[model samples]
Target: MHELIVSPYMGRFVMVKPGRKEGGTMPAYLYRELAETAPTSPCPDWLVKAARQAWHTELEGRPLAPAVLVRDDPGLGYGRASWELNLGCNYDCEHCYLGIKDFAGLELPERVRVLHTLRDAGVLWLQLTGGEPMVDRLFTETYAAAYDLGMMLTVLSNGSRLFLPKVLDLLTERRPDRVTLSVYGATEESYDGLTRRKGAYRLFKKGLDAGHEAGLPLSLSMIVTRHNAHEVPMMRHIAERIGAPMEEYTNMVPTIYGGDETLPTQSAEHLRRRKPFTGCNAGHTFFHVNPFGRASICKVGRDPAVDLLAEGVEGLSRLGAIADSLLLRQGGCTGCGLQGTCGTCMPLVQLYRKAEAPLATYCQHREKEESV
Candidate 1:
C-alpha cells in the first residue's frame, strides 16, 4: 500500500494501483524476491518485471473505494480466458491430465472456429495450451492471426518444439508475449520416467537453448510433487541455465480436462498445511475453455458447470453466473497463514483432498509448471 511492490528488474516509475505492488515493476534486483512474494501467477521474472513497469504506466492505476463501493465493478483484477488450443502433444508424461486424450477426435475447421470465437469475446489475453502446442495443426496460423488482431498471446510449451524451422518461424512472426515451459525431472531418467518418453529432456533443453539463442523471452515452471518437491533448487538451476526465472507451486488437485469432481490421482495426499484459497471467484476472473466447446471458470475444476464450448462466444461474455458460483473465503481462508501467500486454487481445494496429499494435482509434475 505504501511502498510500490515491484519486480526486481524495475525501479519506482509507474504505479498501477495504490495498493501493494506485488506483480508490478521494480528495480532489476527485486524481480526474484518479488516473484517469490507475489500472491498468485508466476510466469517469468521478466514477466513480473514487465507487469510491474506497465501497471504503474499503462495498466489500471490503484483501485478507488467509492463512498459505497459496489461489488459489480471490475475491482482490483482482470478477466481472461484460457483456451486449450489442441490436446495433442509431442511427448507423453505420466501425470499428464489429458495424457493420450489430448489427441482425441476433433475437426480441423472446428478448432480454428474456437479461436475466432474467443477473439470475438474481446479477450485481451489469450492462452494457447494443450498436450503440446507445437503439435497443433494450425498452431502457426493461429499465432499469426492472433498477433495480427492485437491479442496478447501466451503459450504453454515443453520447449522441445521451438527448434523446428516452421515453428521457429511462427515465433519470429508472432513474437509472443510469453512462452512457459514445464520441466519435471532435472535428470533424463527422472524426466523420462515422469514423461514416459525418453529423450524428451534433451528435446526440452534443445528448445530452451534455441529460444535463448534466438532471443525469445521465456519463463520456466516446476510442480512440487512427492518425487520432486525436494528438487526445487535443481529446478531453479535449470531455469537459470536457460537464462529464465522460476516459480515453485504448492500441489493442487487436478480437474482432468475439467472432467469431474474427483480426487486427484497424482497429487501428494499429505502436504504441509498452511492455508486455503477460497471464496475467490476463480470462474469469473480466471477461465478455462476446453476443446469441443467445453468451458469452466476455474482451470483446476473438473466440472465447468456451464458449457461455453457449445454455447459459443456469447455464452462466455455472460460471466456473471460463473463468477457467482465461486465459494468465498469464509473462515478457513481468512484464519490460515497461507491464505494469500501461496498460489491457491479455490475450486481445487474445496473439491478434492485425497489420502496422500492435501493438494492432489500440481503443475502437471513438471519443473516449469510453477508458473501456473
Candidate 2:
C-alpha cells in the first residue's frame, strides 16, 4: 500500500498518512483529478511536490499513484468509530466504568470480518479500546489488520503492557495515531491500592519508559479518584517529565450496565463543573461498536444498537434515528427550565438515574451543585 492517504475530512479535502503523524491539504480540483487517474499512472509533478513537502521524502518514478487516495462513498455517511476489542483487563481498578471485566471476544477470523465491515462503512478514524485492549490475545493481529485497511488507529490502554517486546515492536514499526495511557497514581502504594493489582505501578512505569524510548506517540489520561486525589500534582509532574500532554478526569460515572459500584470512588473535592451540552454528531458522523459487532450511537447511549455481523453495514441506517430518539430531553428531564443550562447529556442522565445515584452527581436541580 502507498505511504500516503488522500481523502475528504468532514467538508475539506486533505492528504494524511495512515498513522496520521504527518499530512497537508490539497485543493478540490487535485482531489477530483487523482480519483479519475489510474492506480499505476505516473505520480504527477504537483502530487510529488506536495508529498515531498508533507512527508519530507523524495519519490522515485511511479512509486505513488491514485491507489493511495480514498474515494468518498455516497452511501456511507459515518467517518469514525470505536471498537471495544474485549472487556478483559489485568488491573481491576475500583473506579472502572466497565463493572464486570470479562476476557471474552471474537476470534481472529470473525474479527477480520468486523474490521472489513468497518472499512466498508467508510470509517477512517478508528479507536481500539477495551477493559484493556492490550490484554486481548489477538490484539496485534487485529491492530495490523485495521492499519492495513487504511484506518488511522488509536489505542486506549493502561500502559502496563507496553513493556512487552512483541507489542513494543509492532507499535514501533506500525505506529498508531496515538496511544492514550491512563495514569491512576504517582506512587506505587496508591496505584496498586486503587487497581488492586500488586506491581501494577512498576509495570506501568516500565511501560512508559519503554514506549518513550521507542519513540512512540503517547498521551496520558490522569484519572483522579479518592484513592489518588492527593497525588494529582505528582501525576502532573510525571507527565511533564515525560513531555506528554496530560488531561485530568475527576468525574466518576456509573458502569455501562448502570451499576452504582463505581460512584463511591469519586473524589468530591476534585469534581469540576462540566460545560453545557450543546450537541454532537455521534450516530451521524461517528459511531461505536462492541466486541460482538453491535453498533451504537456512542458509548454511553448504547441501547437500540445495530448488529453489524448480522445486518452488515446496512444496519447503520437505524443509528441516526436511534441517536435522535435518545437525545430528546424526555424522561425526568422533560419540560425542565434547567434544560438550557444542563451540563450532562440525556443518556448519561439515564445511567445516573438507573444507578439511583444522588441527584448532586449529575442533575442541575441539586441544592448543592458545587460538589458531588
Candidate 3:
C-alpha cells in the first residue's frame, strides 16, 4: 500500500512506497535542516501540523507516521493531473493533435476507478481535456466523481456543445474550477474555414454565451497557425468583449502519429525567440492520462506509458524513473549549444525520430538557430 503525504495549502503531494525507510526517529536539528532544503514554497498549515505530530511522536521513542515526515522530504512531487477523456471530436480541425482517430475510451466504471486512483495518489488539480471532453458520454460522470472527491477540476472544450440545455445545466450545477474554450477564428468565414465545418462560428459563440450565462469563469485559447494567425487580434478582442482572458499558442509540432501537415509551424527564429520551455513537466509535477487509461508524463509521450487500469498504484513508480531518464544531463542534449532555443529533447526526439538520431525537422531548427 502506498501512502500520500499532502500539503493542503500549497497543493503538493509526496507518494511514499512501502518499506522506503527514509524517515524515522532522527535529531530535531536534522529534521529542521531537511525541511529547509525542501522546495522553496510557503509551508502550509497542514505541513506545520504534520511536523508537530512527527516531533511529538519522535520524542516518545517511536517513528512518526511516514505521511507526517514525508512533508519535509521530496521523494514524490505530483501536484497536477490531466486526462484526455476521449479522442473523438465533432469538428475536424486540420491541426488536431490526436489526428482524426475515433478511439473508444475507457468505460464509465473504469474511468471512475482511474479517478479514484489519481486522487489517492495525491493529485490536487485535475484537468479534463480531449478532442472535446464535453462531447464524451462519460464526461458528466467523471466530472461529477472528481468533483465529489474534492479534486479541483478544469474542462477544456471547443465550446460547440456548451449551448445545449443539459450541458449548461451540468456546468451550472458542478461549476468546475475553471473552463477553457478554444476559439479557432474570430469570424465565421475564417473559423469555419479552419474547422472545415459550416456554421461552426455561430455554435462556438453560443457555447461561449452559455458559459458566461452560467457564470462560469472562462479562458480563451487560439491555436496560431498560418491559416488563422491573422485573426489573433480579432480573437483577443472577442475574448475581451466576453470578459475572458485570451492566450495565443504558435508552437505547433507534428501530430502524435506524425500525419497532419495542414497547419504550418512558426519559424525557427520565432520559436527560439520565445522563452525556453524545453523539457515537459511530464512525470514530475504533471501527468497526462489518455482515454485508453494509458498514463504518461505528457500527451505526446505515448510510446512510453503505463496502463493504469492494468497495474494501478504499483505502476506509478515508473513515473519517477521516467522523470529521471528525461533529465537533460542523462542525454546528448546536455551540452548542446541550442539548449534554450531548440525545443527537441530526448522525449520529443523519441516521439518523432525514425532512427537512432533526431529527425531533420528538429535539426533544421537547431541549424537555423546556429546560423543566426
**Of the candidates shown, which would achieve the greatest TM-score relative to the real structure?**
2
Order the candidate numbers by lDDT, best to worst.
2, 3, 1
Query: Which lDDT tens digits does candidate 1 get at residues 25-72?
Result: 235334344334333333344433454565533222332211101111
lDDT scores in order? 0.56, 0.87, 0.67
Off by more than 4 A, model 1: 1-79, 105-108, 250-252, 255-275, 302-310, 326-346, 349-372
Question: TM-score, each model?
Answer: 0.64, 0.95, 0.74
lDDT string for model 3 (1-372, tens) is 103232331232332212121223444443454455443343444444444454332212222343333333323556678999988887888877677657579898899899877866667578999888888988888888876665667889999998888878876776666788998888899899888899989999999988887788788987776677777779888888978887777665666775435325443333423445456667867778989888887876665788989988678779867766765443445676656666455565554553233344554465565788
User: Could you tell me the lDDT of residue 157 within candidate 1?
Assistant: 92
Q: How displaced is residue 214 in candidate 3, in Å? A: 1.6
lDDT tens digits by residue: candidate 2, 179-287: 9999999999999999999999999999999999988889999999999999999999988998999999999999999999999999999998888887789898899
Error of model 2, residue 247, in angstroms: 1.0
Q: Is candidate 1 or candidate 2 better by TM-score?
A: 2
Clashes of 2: 0
List RMSD in Å for every model shown. Answer: 13.0, 2.2, 9.8
- Which candidate number maximizes lDDT? 2
As a whole number from 0 to 100, the lDDT of residue 79 in candidate 2 is 83
| lDDT, residue 74, model 2 | 38
State how far residue 119 of model 2 sits from its true place (Å).
1.3
How much is 243 displaced in model 3, in angstroms? 1.9
